[model samples]
Target: MPMTKFLKNDKGLTLIETMLSITILGIVMLGVMTLFKQAYLYTVLNEDKTIGINVARNALMYMEKQNFIEIKEKFASLGNNGQLQLLVCEHNGSARYTLIDSNTSPLSGCSDIQINDRKYNVTIETEPPKNNNSDYANYFIPLVVKVTWKHGNIEQSTQLKGVLTSEDIR
Candidate 1:
């Protein structure tokens, strides 16, 4: 009889029970917030990567459209006394043009690009083509384009490669 009366009077949680419930809810909310933070960070990193790759690819494609002669002419105007020479080399039985960056050393003609209000540095490197059976070097030139940017004190970069053949000269 006494137990029944006590149970009837208990209509709500005790103070300790209420505090424990509130604590558990807070912990769960903290965990969820942490997960969301990580996900957002990951998304940001992936977006940067994608942008870098695209920039490099665009640079490479631009080079691909130019033939060896055109590139030589362009570089000749840039300086180094027409030192930009393409050499033919044989590698693994295939012929390829090797790009020689003469007196310019690091070479010039790099362009800057902007994406998402962020600035990126893009550089292009050239090499002579390589092939098997022939020593003709002016047939093609290999190019590498690299894109770099600073992401929160960390440097990030991406590179893409392509070849410009003489046939492309039109």
Candidate 2:
């Protein structure tokens, strides 16, 4: 009779039922936490990729501002000390603006930058002019600016390509 009474008095969860429910909830919570961790990792990686693109763009802009004829020379002329020298020459109506002088470099430059504790290695490249018969082809050169950085254990890079021509429309 006492056992029957005890069985009839059951209310809410028994110890075994409570423990099982808790275990199920813990498993679900673990899955949710793992998902959140993966999402956060992707967000950080995307941020680094975007930053790399912006860095490449800024380097391209700087290249665009340099003397169009000497952009290629400057890229190839980095000194042993790792410094890019800026060459300035003024051609008053009296002389041809030729950069092939034996005493001077054609003119190319490189620079390193850091943002948000990330270091960037920037490089510029130029290729021979394509086969366009336009008179302006002599003044055209292909340009590419690349920015690279280490994002955690992986290496990331971005590039911007363009054609440089004489700044003078005439």
Candidate 3:
């Protein structure tokens, strides 16, 4: 255990070498953690988009199945820029439908829709038929279904367009 014998022991790492190794490992781990955070963020964003698209499609389908006569009566009262009434199904897997008038603010009653802790707002707008298509102008009901939600600080939305041929129209 003399000084000369201890200094000759090259098999073990020096104190400086061990500290440098730990510092490098820490830097590499920090970069890896950053990548994981970004991946999770993108995954959640994509999930919200997919759910928004599903909500829009379901709303469009529901409106299409209803009697055009009754729907016309509802829209007729509002005239131009009439928003269709959206009834969201039960939030807890029940088929119950609740009517929410689009004339009010989207953040009103529709705010009850919450999935995975995210609140979704759905709105349907009736657009006038295109000028180029005169035949459709009389017989077609142009509709746009938009589903909006807040993802963190940004508000994200998706829309689906559909045309319903009216049998009641002359």
TM-score to native of every candidate shown: 0.60, 0.60, 0.67
lDDT of 2 by residue, 32-57 (tens): 99999999989987897788788767
Candidate 3 clashing pairs, residues 3+ apart or interchain: none
> CA shift at 130, candidate 1, in angstroms?
7.0
lDDT of 3 by residue, 64-90 (tens): 776776666677777787775565454
lDDT of 2 at 21: 96
Please give me the total number of clashing residue pairs in predicted model 1: 18
Off by over 4 Å in 2: 1-10, 72-111, 128-140, 151-155, 168-170
Model 2 residue 83 CA deviation in Å: 13
Better of 1 and 2 by lDDT: 1
